[model samples]
Target: MWWFWTLWAVVALTHCSAMDRNKDKALKLMKQTPLIDGHNDLPWQIRKQFNNQLSKVDLNTIQTTHTNIPKIKEGHLAAQFWSAYVPCDTQHKDAVRQTLDQIDIIHRMCDAYPESFMFATSSQDIMEAFIQNKTASLIGVEGGHSIDSSLGILRIMYRLGVRYLTLTHSCNTPWVDNWKVDTGTEAPVHNGLSPFGKQVIKEMNRLGMLIDLAHVSEKVMNQVLDLSKAPVIFSHSSAYSLCQHKRNVPDAVLKRVRDKAGIVMVNFYNDYVTCSQTANLSQVADHFDHIKKVAGHTVIGFGSDYDGVRRVPKGLEDVSKFPDLVAELLRRGWNDTEVRGALGENLLRVLKDVERVRDSLTKDQPDDVPIPYEQVENACRTNYGYFPLDNTGHSASQSPLVLALATLLCWFFGGSSYSCRP
Candidate 1:
């Protein structure tokens, strides 16, 4: 009995020592390299809190339920893209105006807390902000539809500091189809992009705005990948091979992104990361592991769709939980360099590429013309065999055995899908 107790004590001490080593390593990584989250809806969250009136709030005293200056500092977020998102609705007659409002809020926040935050358009700006001990405030338009299908508006948006534009949101635009709607039970309206949509991508390439393919259809994603002269960003997405969500990118897509030297900012949305519809922390970490296996370290970064997401993972309940994720990654055997890339350096590289592309484009270049709706309607009918299968024998539309089984299960259960509780 004495020998057994002694053996147990030695094992426990070894385990504790290992845990301490991991904790120290994680803390060092966090301190050395700060995290850069690609997308967060803090502007919209502010809009909601201030009663759709940004001017009324005392920027210094502003308190938010989700994200704020104090919370961001506490969370150790070095850089973030304050997403200018507008909901898809005909009722919101001027979507562009609403988006501008959100942008104004971000600008106000930066101006109000100059010591704490700085507006960053270039990778250099981000590095500068870090050196100054300030959080970098970057901007991204969440939907292409927010521009009201005007090239002039898009240029103006870029001028106003929008770095990236998510080509589509939850709804299909006149040019591109959203992956969610197109892949759903409803028939696809446009196969990928109308001729106009292709032009939009080219214009984005020329303008230096990183053409984001986060919410676009797989066909649209392919089209943009072919059309973009510069690297693109899936600002907030994950690996679909792991979670099997329309919102997540498939392994083939990730491979193409890697080949282009682009960045796939791994989204922290629970549904996108996990098989479970409800939020689960360990499952979220599993997605990071899976994405790394497929995309490699260079292409991976963080894109936590914070306020925009319905449910966050258990460990990552709020911005403050970011340290826990860093710790978890360290526990999983990620070295400091790997952790730094996942945090922000990878994103900085993509940002620099976008700035270079923007500088190369000429202002006098011809604007992209919109393709006629009739032409788009005609093309979808003729486009067949566009959905190519992967090595696993799964096309973009549906996977082979797993999807087939899911379909049968839904049918057997009277069209009710399984829902796992959090």
Candidate 2:
């Protein structure tokens, strides 16, 4: 028994030593380069659990959730795309307001921890944060519902420092189908993308927003690959070939993403990683490896859905487990270059490229493509708007009520309102 105990102790000590070495190497690489994660739902978690009260919740304290300042520091995360996730319930009603609140919460979260976090909207900002040893908190809207099918709302969100927009969630927006289309659970509303949805992609390109295809249907994914001029990303998804989940990216789409210079940021939810409730770190790494095989290493990144899912992979249990995954990659013979790119460089390059596309479209006027009323007309929708424009795009409506209002305006404002040119 004494000999057995001694042998077990030796083996345990050797294992600990190896893990320590791996952690040290991973930490060293991350310190020099920015380790950016594509998606996190800490904002949503804070909203639900803490009532959006940062004063009541301590980011420094380790809570039951996956995210906390201590775990984030331990994770060596240089940049994070905090998801401003509006629920499907808010889609037609108040998704925009909820999304705005989420963004505000993220901003406040950064402000609360000024020393540890800072708002970042570009690759350069990420690099600066890396140099300054602060977490670059970038914004990502988790669903197109957040924009309520309005390009105007989308533009405003982009102006608010939201760097990416997921085209769908569990529910489809009026202009796009969600993953349910592939799962055979819900029929697609837009087939792939409505004409308006295509415009959303174009507008996002012009705004330099990274088009996130995580929760979109397979048709939508293929459509976006064909449509978007800028590099797209699956901000938090895994390999469909492995998990067989509709939320996961199929291998063919992964190849297409590679061709388009897009990236697929792997998700770490146990179900998405292994198609089961219980999974391990190895399973999570398997997703990265499979996506890398199909999409190439440069197109693979991390997007642990921290605080978003309840069941996480075992070894990658919390935000702090990022280095462990990196270490696993190193053990699997991933070179420093591949590891570095996956850490942050690849996503950063995508950001710069998207920005360049926006710059090229600097003189291009915004395409105000509106969703056709027939397509979206339902009990859920209300037609409160008047003055719908025509092909000439003039002040369109001349209803008697409108005319009476115009007559009053003309009487008051020196007859200027009578002009139809507006």
Compare the candidates by lDDT and give the number of the best one: 2
Query: How does model 2 fare in lDDT?
Result: 0.87
The alpha-carbon RMSD values of the candidates against the true structure, listed in the order shown, are 12.9, 7.2
Q: What TM-score does each of the candidates earn?
A: 0.82, 0.89
Worst 10 residues of 1 by lDDT: 376-385
lDDT value, residue 62 of candidate 1? 57
lDDT, candidates in the order shown: 0.78, 0.87
After TM-score superposition, the amount by which residue 241's alpha carbon in candidate 2 deviates from its true location, in angstroms, is 1.5
User: Please, what are the lDDT tens digits per residue for candidate 1 over residues 276-302?
Assistant: 757665676676787778878888888
Q: lDDT tens digits, residues 40-88, model 2?
A: 9999888988878878888899486889998999999999999999789
Evaluated against the true structure, the overall lDDT of model 1 is: 0.78
